[model samples]
Target: MSTFLTLLRRDCAQLLLGGRRGGALLPVLFFLAVAMLYPFAVGPDAPLLARTGGGVIWVAALLAAILPLDRLIEPDLELGLFDQFALRGISEEGVVAVRVLAHWLSFGPPLMLAALPASALVGIDGAQLRLIEWGLLAGTPGLAALGVLVAAITAGLRGGAALGGLLVIPLAVPLLVFGAGSLSAGGEAGLALTGAVSLVLLAITPFAGAAAIKSSRG
Candidate 1:
């Protein structure tokens, strides 16, 4: 228990504090850039911005989630940290689970906060912003899990980071659909589905990521 907490704290610091892997701020900046540029790209059509802003936020969040994938598992693997954990009788699954939580912490809540200004930039109202916040809260865990899982699978491969980013987009379509769809009328069901998909991905990620890490050792 102590070791787990310690590792969790270490990872959260590494990811959030802007080590060589970059910090949580990179994704937040990218997210805001998207929001800020989107209005210009489409011109000053307020209704259009309001109507489409939630989906844009969802897409931005998805892309922002991808930015940190290369650093998530590969850096530790390169440092032989996983081996050290193994020597100490810690399972890969446990490490990966801790990492997922840390990764989510590094970006998820920050994105939720960033969304407030982003909402203004994109012309979404208070009601729509509330739904967007709920969607992000329910869905970002799945994004984090997916990012870690993909990073573990592609670790040690040539050009793995780019490959991981590509893989994340396609694999994350379900979360994207339900998350963005939740902005529409009769959208509570979409929120439920988003949470359900998030739960499934969270459930599967630890074991799948552990297996991927083990296989990469061969």
Candidate 2:
């Protein structure tokens, strides 16, 4: 427990420092802005806007989750920081888990915030807004975990981005399906349950990714 806390703190420190380096927050913000344009481009029909907002927000979240992965892990691996983590008495699994958590924290909350205004623009009700937030919260962490694993595997490979995308897209399918589909339905509990599944999927990702990274590192 203490070790995990220490690792989480260390990873948080590294990510916070990275923020000072600039360009870190830009991609998620850009994604949020672009997602808002979809409704305006479709024009000011309330039904259409409401219908599309949830799907657009979910899709935008997935893309935003993927955006930072390549850059996030590549720099660390290239500069030998990942290797340093392994050598510093931290378990490789812990290193990978902390990295995933950091990436998710950096990318997820801003994307969530950015989604709110877009949700309003799209005429999302309070209930749907809550659902969208719930879905994103549950789904993005899984995406982040998959991102970490794929980023690590493709770290030094040529065409790594393409390879990483291929690996992650299949894993992301369930998240996309349940997340977006749940929004269209009327029942709150059913939608919430579906959202819960997505969250569980997100929670499970780091464990699998950590094991894979550990095996690969060995």
Candidate 3:
């Protein structure tokens, strides 16, 4: 338990407080930038913006999740940090689990916070903004876990960053469908389904990431 706490702290520092690189500030800025640009491109049709803004937010969040992918696992792998963890009897699963938690904490909450201004920019009302926030809360965990999975898989490969982005798009469809789909329906069912998917991804991430890390070492 102590070791896990220590590792979690280390992961958080590396991923959340490493200044400009991993403070999670960058992804929030990128997400808001996307939301900000979307309105101008689509013109000031308030009705159109209001109707589609939530979905646009979802897309921005999804892309923002990808922004940190290449750095997630590669930094540790390259520094042989995983090797040290293994030597200390820290299983890859344990490392990956903590990493998943740290990853989500790093960007997920901030993205949620940033969504408020984004909602205003896109012209969503208070109610719609609430739904979008709810949807993101349910779904960002899955997106975080998905990012870790992709990062682990592509950590050491050539052109891995590009490959990771491409790989993430298809896998992210379900989250996009259920999460972004929820806003249109104005129902809890879609949010519930999104959470279910998130739980599944969270459950599998440790093992899958461990496997991918091991495979990369070979």
> Which of the numbered candidates is closest to the native, going by highest lDDT?
1
- Candidate 3 regions with alpha-carbon error over 4 angstroms: 20-22
| CA lDDT of every candidate | 0.95, 0.71, 0.92
Give the C-alpha miss distance for residue 160 in model 2, angstroms. 1.2
In candidate 2 the C-alpha lDDT for residue 159 amounts to 82
Q: Please, what are the lDDT tens digits per residue for candidate 1 over residues 131-208?
A: 999999999999999999999999999999999999999999999999999999888788999999999999999999
Report RMSD (Å) for each prediction in the order shown.
0.7, 2.9, 1.1
What's the TM-score of every candidate structure? Answer: 0.99, 0.82, 0.97
lDDT of 2 by residue, 104-123 (tens): 77777777787788787678
Q: How many pairs in model 3 have backbone atoms within 3 A of each other, for residues 3 or more apart or on separate chains, i.e. clashes? A: 0
Q: Model 1: how far is 185 from its true place, Å?
A: 1.1
**Candidate 2, which segments miss by more than 4 Å at Cα?**
1-6, 13-17, 20-24, 187-218
Better of 1 and 3 by TM-score: 1
- The lDDT, on a scale of 0 to 1, for candidate 3 is 0.92
Predicted candidate 3 versus true structure: per-residue lDDT over 110-154, tens digit per residue? 999999999999999998888888999999999999999999999
Task: Supply candidate 3's per-residue lDDT for 104.
Answer: 97
